[model samples]
Target: MHGLPQAEPTNATIRPGAAARRSPGWRISRRVRIGLASLIGTFALWWLLTDITGVIGPHRFPAPAEFWAAFVQIAIDGYAGGTLITQAWYSTRLVIMGFLVAIATGVPLGLLMGVSHRAEALLNPAFLLVRPIPPLAWIPLAIVWLGLGDAAKILVIWFAAFVPSVINTWTGVRGVDRTLIAAARVHGAGELRLLWEVIIPGSLPMMFTGLRLSLQASWTTLVAAELVGAFFGLGRVLDAAYRDINPPMIAVAMLAVGVLGALTTRLVAVAERRLIPWRS
Candidate 1:
């Protein structure tokens, strides 16, 4: 019998037309991989310098292993008048509340400013002046007006987040192409319809960028806000650690704040991609 060569298993050959796409969950983006690797490398360097080699003393900077051990205990046992979870939750909740408020107020004002000269004239001077002032500068006034409570903390976070949101939203709208507007009008789009369908969509990328900036501001200023009148939070933990000279506790709080900030930012980024798939 003449034997014809059997072809390699059909599945082994790559298909000719388009490559198969991976589902979102199945794909880890390159940036995430690089960032994780960088974190690990940085930790390795930190461990070698502080824990293993003893180039830096634990008294000054807790060794990575030391920090890990303490962190485990912190998770189980409450410290500095609040459990670790309580501290984190308090700060995270405040950030969420304040950030949403900022977005709600800022985006509209920004859009109005972009499209209306009257709105810009009314708001611009105050905005420009306030924008440059440090958000923390209001702490003394906040304590006097709102006291050391949720109000003061929320106000601080709000101020921190508001600037970036307004700025970015304004930038996004102002940067919109007038030509695009004209095209939409030629197609009989009404002013309100065009504003919603054209301007808002076009400005989303910038709006999202602003939102991220606001989110960062919200969290970063959280500690400063908590410093005034907080019973429990990372900020309180930090203050206690400073007074007690506890480097490990300081490191733990810092790490938690940073990791939580990263996670929140990632969540917002996912929303950005979903809400504006065209940007992708």
Candidate 2:
């Protein structure tokens, strides 16, 4: 016993405090729980209104259970010429394709107009002249010019998304701090370097705002474009529902749009948070 090492203390086996520190804090976890509870409560209220109380007839409004049932049935059995997911993909592809093209061209052109006098002189007036026209009004003209294919729909969405992209991007670039630009120049940063290092980062916040707006525009325009003549899309489903006066199908499409919009907006917020550490 004299030479034996003492046994390690059993008290040192673990630290509950350390584990607690790694877990979420009360405020954040509580807020998340509350938000989820509120969402479920809203759905529950709708269910009660239609099903239990019958104050709202099921014909006029499907219960939550019935709506979800219809959703699943459409997803599996195929509605509006294809399954719900299939239709969603058709709409989503159109939105993303047109939205991407709009931002790709619009943001760069906007930045150029903001920074270059010649570009602004040449492009600004025409842009100002055309931008105020309603996005949906382009649908008929696009169909005539591009034909009633995906190209026409894409053109419509592009017009809808492009305006917001250019306007916001221009605002961001034009609002860049002149002092920062001057400082970059004084520090021996060249024209390219000044733009890359000073202007772009400063303008990212506004550009991100534009992206959110473009997202909304893309969705709204896609729905309109689809209504004109689409083989498969939520808008087409809504069109049918309108004709049939099918409340359940209408509710499904409406809910789908709301959910998609919320999720995408949340994703953009997350991306902004991660990408722009300076903001936080």
Candidate 3:
């Protein structure tokens, strides 16, 4: 008994596969589960309300089934000789052009405003006044000046997008840490070097935020422009459906618009992630 080793407590032993068992399942967090459940519940409620209670007539407010049927038909047969696919392409192209224009002009102007006090003083009041005007309010002038063509639509979309982008980009650059700029100067960094290496990188997150806002604004304006007068686009299809008093078609068009907008939003988010990887 004097030389014998004492036994270790069995309860203190670590199980070989215990960690494996305790590993998270699908890593599904509570928030994600709740969000998914909420979406499903919303769809279920919508289906029940529209299908069961004929509270609104089919012509006025069609059922979900009716809208789905119309969507399928449009997908297969096309809308007014052009399929939803074609209309979507047309709308997408217009949005891209307008967005590109806004980016090209807005970024440089925003940088100027952020960098130079004189430029900011000269332009800030003009931007404040112009930004407040609704894109829809510009419709009549766009039509008169650019005609009821692609130009009018593109201009409207550009106007809707430009303000947010410029404002956000300007804010981002202006908000850069002053101490960082001072440090850069103390290290013998020139104005160009400081801007290119430090300021631009620091301002990128805010610029991306502005770009996201601009994309949404542009998309909304595109629809409004198309609704006013256009031969092709999702908005035009909706307009035609309205004229025909076809609630089902209208609902289908609405769904298409929602889907497209969501897709664009996701695209912007992806771009933001890639461009601003420093952001959490």
Candidate 4:
């Protein structure tokens, strides 16, 4: 009996390559390869349609070379008296301002509503009414109230972001485990302790989800807000390009919006990883 070899765990035999599959680096590398392939394939199709076939006219859609030329021109020579960098920064700044304000205001109010039935009853109906309204709808009122300034732009962006933040946060808090709440209560945890230890930690993932959504909303609304009266922003760049019938410049501006949005989303992802490392 002492000389007999010990049996290998049954689980080990069933999970071949499981460790490799579970490796974080392996997963990340796989995702990177897939994403790169997708981008390359898209660009190849675009190039084929525009440059090779010429089925799509330059006036309708700029070729890759034209797009590159337009990008370089805006990056160096400037457009409407502002370089692309400055214009993109203007839009990004508005997004940041509005996003931060939404987070600051929405999270606390959401927490209140989540914990208090009375508060929820009082606020939920109003939020429901406002949630269906489009951010673009706020543009006319914003111009009237705040004029053609950054304030008007920020207001529009703020409204776009605020609803998602509050809704997601509220939903997150409400989604916290009732069993955990009961256990905490049984253990004589006070309401504040229950909130801090049991609720907030549990709800953080959803809260961060809300933040990401809010940031996206901010970027999307920034473009529309700037379209109305901004002197310097990607949206204004787009407007000018349209008025001049310059497809290349329009393509450049649209690309800038997409790139900037992606960059900001990356920033939010980094923050999410830092704040919620367990989930990451």
Candidate 5:
């Protein structure tokens, strides 16, 4: 055994992270568990306050049974000659139309402004002038121009969505690394190629941020947008409920709006993940 060299340890002999690989781990995360518990506790508290103690009356806040009854009434008996589904569809349709229009125009304009100083100089003044005005302010002009129809509502919603999209996109594009752009130029990449390959990719994260904001803006503006001419929408339902002094109906409509906003925002997140797979 004198002067004999020892054999090197093989991977088969030493397995790092073997325990980690074997462990099933917690299937449900702590955050998720806490969230579930919080929701359950909140509902329990609401039940206690409303049903058990009667401290909160149905006039102020509907009990679970009252809420359910209102939901059924709207679902079955309908509201303003349109069922809940019909109203929801109308609102969703308006949102989609306005949202699409906003992105279609806003993205290109933002990109152009970001890429060319001349474009920014020419447009920035007007953009700045108009951007500060709230979307609600446009309602009167929309009514005068497009009349009391879907177009007017869409216009208002478009304004709501457009500002953030442009601002965010422009910021995103401008924020792209100058070094990368210069490197791309050194590699003989033309303006178009540089924009497509580098600029868009670099800017996508902020662009998506803009998109999410735009989506929220669309939903937030929906109720106001529908105020003028909409005969059937969640906004209309809320308005009608308020007019009729029906607290349960108002709660149901508000819940519907909240649910729809959440669903749409989720869709945008899904799209962002699909398009920007590299983002964590």
Candidate 6:
């Protein structure tokens, strides 16, 4: 007994279970509930103002019920002999292609500019001059160069998405802590190794921020691009509805665009959360 070791109590080990895992879902549901409530309240106010007060005539600002009915009809019957699904698919494809092009060019260019003063000096002025020009302004040039097809739409979206990504990536790379670079060098890390390991990891958060902004810009520009001189997109559907003075159809198109944009933004947010898990 004098030489024996004493046994220790384990206490009640309280490890998290499935219930704890479910808490995130509950939190998400609570937030969704709040959002839905707010949307419902806002729509109620809109309906009351339009229907009861008659501040804006029903002919001009059609009743919310009418819009809802129209939206349902369009969803069921499709638009301009083409399904809403078709138009949405076309727009989504163009956006994705354009976004990919932007990232391919912008990220490398940004990294070059960030790492090399000469590259920045050579390219920055041109980018600054070009960036201020709106995507709509490029529509004429895009049409001239690529014509009234998928190519033109994709080009317009690329222009819209590229600038923010390049600027943000450049900023991120430039902002990497100098001490990390020195330490990497001290450890005999080669330029490529340092860049891949130290610089990229450090700069990833800002790059993701840029990516999110680029996606938003791409979504906004897609409608404008389709409206200018093209067919088979949500924007084109909206344009046709406007021309026909079909307010309900117009509302449906608008709602579709808003939902798609919100969904894209949320997807990007999810990616950001997963990729940058260290961030609060």
Worst 10 residues of 1 by lDDT: 15-24
| Candidate 6 wrong stretches, greater than 4 Å | 1-30
Clashing pairs in 4: none
How well does model 5 score by local distance difference test?
0.87
User: TM-scores, in order shown?
Assistant: 0.87, 0.87, 0.86, 0.87, 0.88, 0.86
State each model's CA lDDT, in order: 0.85, 0.83, 0.85, 0.88, 0.87, 0.83
Query: What's the CA RMSD for each of the models?
Result: 6.5, 7.7, 7.6, 7.6, 8.3, 8.6
TM-score of 4: 0.87
Stretches of candidate 2 exceeding 4 Å from the true structure? 1-28
Off by over 4 Å in 3: 1-32
Q: Which candidate is the best by lDDT?
A: 4
After superposing candidate 4, which stretches have Cα over 4 Å from the reference? 1-28
Residue 257, model 2: Cα distance from true site in angstroms: 2.0
The global Cα lDDT (0 to 1) of model 2 is 0.83
Q: Across residues 183-273, which tens digit of lDDT does each residue of candidate 3 receive?
A: 9999999999999988888899899888888888888998899898888998898899988888888888887888888898899889888
Q: Could you give candidate 2's per-residue lDDT for residues 105-131 as a string of tens digits? A: 888987898889899999989998998
Q: What C-alpha lDDT, on a 0 to 100 scale, does residue 111 get in candidate 6?
A: 87
lDDT of 3 at 184: 95
